[model samples]
Every structure is written in C-alpha cells, then in structure tokens.
Target: MGNSYEDECRRSLAEEQAKSLAGTNNWEHVDRERVHQDWDVLYREITPFLDGGSLPGDQQIQEFVRRHFDIVCRFYTPSREAYVGMSLFYAEDEAMRAFHDSYHPGLVEFLGAAIKVFAEQGSGFAPSAGEASA
Candidate 1:
C-alpha cells in the first residue's frame, strides 16, 4: 500500500513546522534537544491525569501547565494572549494536534484546556479562579 493519509499529514506538518521556524532569529538560540526532552517529560507526566479522567482545571494538571509555560519561556516570554493563542493553536491546528496526540490520545485537547486555565489564573499576569474550566 502507499503511504497512509496520516503519514502524509505528518510529513506535511513537519515541512510546515520547519518552514515556519526557518530564518527566525528568535528561535536560533533555542536548545531544541532540551526542548524535546522537556516536552517528552511533560507528556509522560500529564498522560496519567488524562487517563484518570481529570479535568483540565485540576490542581495537578494546572501545575503541569505552569511547567509548560516555563518550557515556552525558555525560548521567549509569552504574554497571556500569546499563551492562550498557543493553546488554541494546539487544539485547532491539525499539525499541532497530530504531533501532540501522537504521544497520547486526546492530549491536545487536554493540554489546551489546561493551558487556558493556567493563562487565566497562574500566568502571573491575570487573576481568576483556580478551578474554572477552559
């Protein structure tokens, strides 16, 4: 059989990611391996909560979201809007969703909601409820 559609999508998304990051000086100094390592750890750390059916606003999940924000900060500081926008992208972008979900099913949606909750509460710029849903 020819390459499956999911494989093709993965290839296309890889290309798109490379193209988007190409020639961006801001990303030049990023420790990509470290970022990948951190992401792997984050993925493993969060999967259990998802598997256990915890809501995104759960305290433990929000803690992971804080770690996620810190990981992003390794490259650049993100305003609250930027953080929420990134979360939306994770949920809405096919490529990003595919990439994240590769580690665990439904990870994209879970992470997105958790990130939104974090952005609203613990991002250090906004003040909101600690238990609100995304």
Candidate 2:
C-alpha cells in the first residue's frame, strides 16, 4: 500500500525534470512544444502501466515516474547532455505543479536530480547556495 523504491525514483525523476524546466526565474512563456516532446519521449520510454486510460494506481504511477527519472538522468550521452538538461528544465513549470503534486510522498528526488543535472551541465543557471543545499 506504500510507494516502492522504484516508484519513488520515477516520481522523483519527473519532478526533477519539471523543476529544472521551470527554472529559477519566471519567464513570459515556456516552450510548450519542447516540453511536450520531452514528455512524449519519457512517456514512450517508460510505458507506464495505465488503467482505464489513466495511470495504473497511485503506486504504479509513482513507479513509472521514478523509472522515467532514472532514464533522464542516466541516458544522457556527452553529446546529448545539453539537450537533456534543457528538456528537464523545461519540464519544471507552474502548469506542471499539479501533475507533480498528484503523487503522494512527492517526487523530491526527481527535483533534486534535475537540479543536479542542470548545474552540472552548465545550463547557464544555478540554484542559490541555499537552494543548492536543499
């Protein structure tokens, strides 16, 4: 009845991707097209088990999110690093807060990973020292 390690990982990945996409500063408009493409890629890669045309169950959804997170973090080759960071950062937007919050226990790990990736990739950004500690 609780979230599994895998589930948590998936959720974390999604959350991280979302936060990174959102970025630290508010922008007039986020590139929805790019976001959708990135999400599509993640969705296709994870192939989350959906039920009744929706995510399987809270537990299953969590697992799917975790798996996607791992893939986003681990799949980036040196050449694709920039794109991966950009895609993950684009995922973090106000519109997605609800989607991220839907999962209980939250996907903090995903958010953390995204931040780490963004920083490491030199996405022309950095979380504040406090945020970095977070």
Candidate 3:
C-alpha cells in the first residue's frame, strides 16, 4: 500500500495473474447465470460476517469459506498453494480488492483470512490475518 514502485508492481502483477486465471478454459463453466446464482447464495451466507454481526471463524463463516474454496477447486486446481496464491491476488490486486471492498470494507481481507484458514486446517498451518492475503 505504500507509494513505492514495488507496491504498484505487485498490484499490477496480481491483476494480470487474476485476468489470466479468469481467461482460462475452465472459466467457461463460470457463466453469468452461474455467477449470479452463486452470488445470491454466497451473499446471503456472507452477510452476517461482512456486516459485523458475526466473526470470521463463526460456523457460517467457515461454511462460506468452505463453499468459496470449493468453487475455486471446481474452476481450477485444488492445491492449497494455488488457493493461497489466489487469495493473495484477491487481497493485493487493486481491482480485485476494489471489487471485494465494494461488497464491504475489509471483505477481501476477511475472505482471504478465512480462505487461508480453511485451506490450512487440514495441514495444521496457521497464518496471520493478512499474511495469507499479503
């Protein structure tokens, strides 16, 4: 977030990475209809956490993150490493961050934390709040 060249470069790189992923053949399965329908369900599920009515690790939140992780697995690889990388892009990429924050302040950060926790639970790895996002 600093004004350094490295920061902007990171943002730009992550944006391109996200674009590349979305442009892949698997993205065909993620049509507008599917996105809209899934968003409806996801929106309902994530609202409480996003609105501060619940915490990040709440059962609903865990389920939401699990569903989110499943979506990513469906579209792409199931590697925890890849999921972690995607979370980085979601939080660090300028456009991705803006899109998620449009839903709520710190939503991307919270989502990143939740996703990383969900992925690492099986591996017994624990990450700092923004470290996975970073």
Candidate 4:
C-alpha cells in the first residue's frame, strides 16, 4: 500500500519546510532527533491543559506556549507577527492540521489558540538556549 495520509502530509510538509530554510545557516546546527524529542515533550506537556479544558490564555497553557516558541526558535527566530501567523497556519493549512490532529484531535486548534495568546502577550524574543538571535 502507499503511504498513509499522515505520512504523505509529513513528507510534503518536510519539503516545504526545507525550502523555508534555504540560505539560512541556522539549519546547520539543528539536531533533527533532538528537535523531534523536544516537540514530543511539548505535545505531551500541553495535552493535559487541553484535556482539562483550560483556556488558551490560562497561565499553565501560556507557559507551554513559551516552550513551544523556544522549540520553534531552534530553526529560526520569528517575529511576533510571524509567530501569530504560524499559529493560524497550523489551523488553516489542511496538511498541518491533519498532521497535528493525528497526534491528538483538536491539538492543532488548541496550539494555535495558545500561540496567539503568547504572541499577544509580547513575550520577549528569547531564542532557545545557546542560540544567538539574528
């Protein structure tokens, strides 16, 4: 059989992601396995807040959003506007929504909400540890 829908989405997203990194030296230091591990941790950590019916702006959920932001910063530093836009993309992009929801139903929406909250709060631009801001 051919790849599942989720697999196909992942493959497609990876290609798009690679293109987004073109000409950026930041990708040179990225550890794919470590980034994946961090994302797993983020998803696991955030699920409880979603399951408990916490709102996106809840203190706990916002804290997790900070972690999520740092994880994303591993690749590139996104402006507040860009970060908010990315959150929206997660919900609006069919493939992104499908990939995220494959982990947990409603996860994409929850994460998008929390990310918007984080961006709205004007969180400082702190890249992940050891990363220099561009």
- Least lDDT summed over 10 consecutive residues: which range in candidate 2? 75-84
RMSD to the true structure for each prediction, in A, is 10.4, 11.9, 7.3, 9.5
Off by over 4 Å in 4: 1-20, 126-134
lDDT tens digits by residue: candidate 1, 1-134: 13363344345444434543664664887898999999999998899888898999999898888888888777655555556667666777899889899988889888877876786687453211222545
Worst ten-residue run, lDDT, model 4? Answer: 1-10
Instruction: Report the Cα lDDT for residue 113, model 3.
Output: 72
Residue pairs in collision within model 4: none
lDDT of 2 by residue, 1-134 (tens): 13363344345445544565566343225555765567656555333233223333344454554444444444321112333343343455555544543442233334434333443444322232124433
TM-score, per-candidate, Cα-based: 0.72, 0.25, 0.63, 0.72
* TM-score of predicted structure 1: 0.72
lDDT of 4 by residue, 1-134 (tens): 13363344344445444554785663887888998898888888777777788999999888888888888877766655556657666887899888778778989988877776787685674332234668
Q: Which candidate would rank higher by lDDT, 1 or 2?
A: 1
Poorest lDDT segment (10 consecutive residues) of candidate 3: 122-131
Judge candidate 4 at residue 100 and give its lDDT. Answer: 79
Backbone clashes in model 1, listed as residue pairs: none
Q: lDDT score, residue 38, model 3?
A: 80
The residue ranges of model 1 lying beyond 4 angstroms of the native Cα positions read 1-24, 125-134
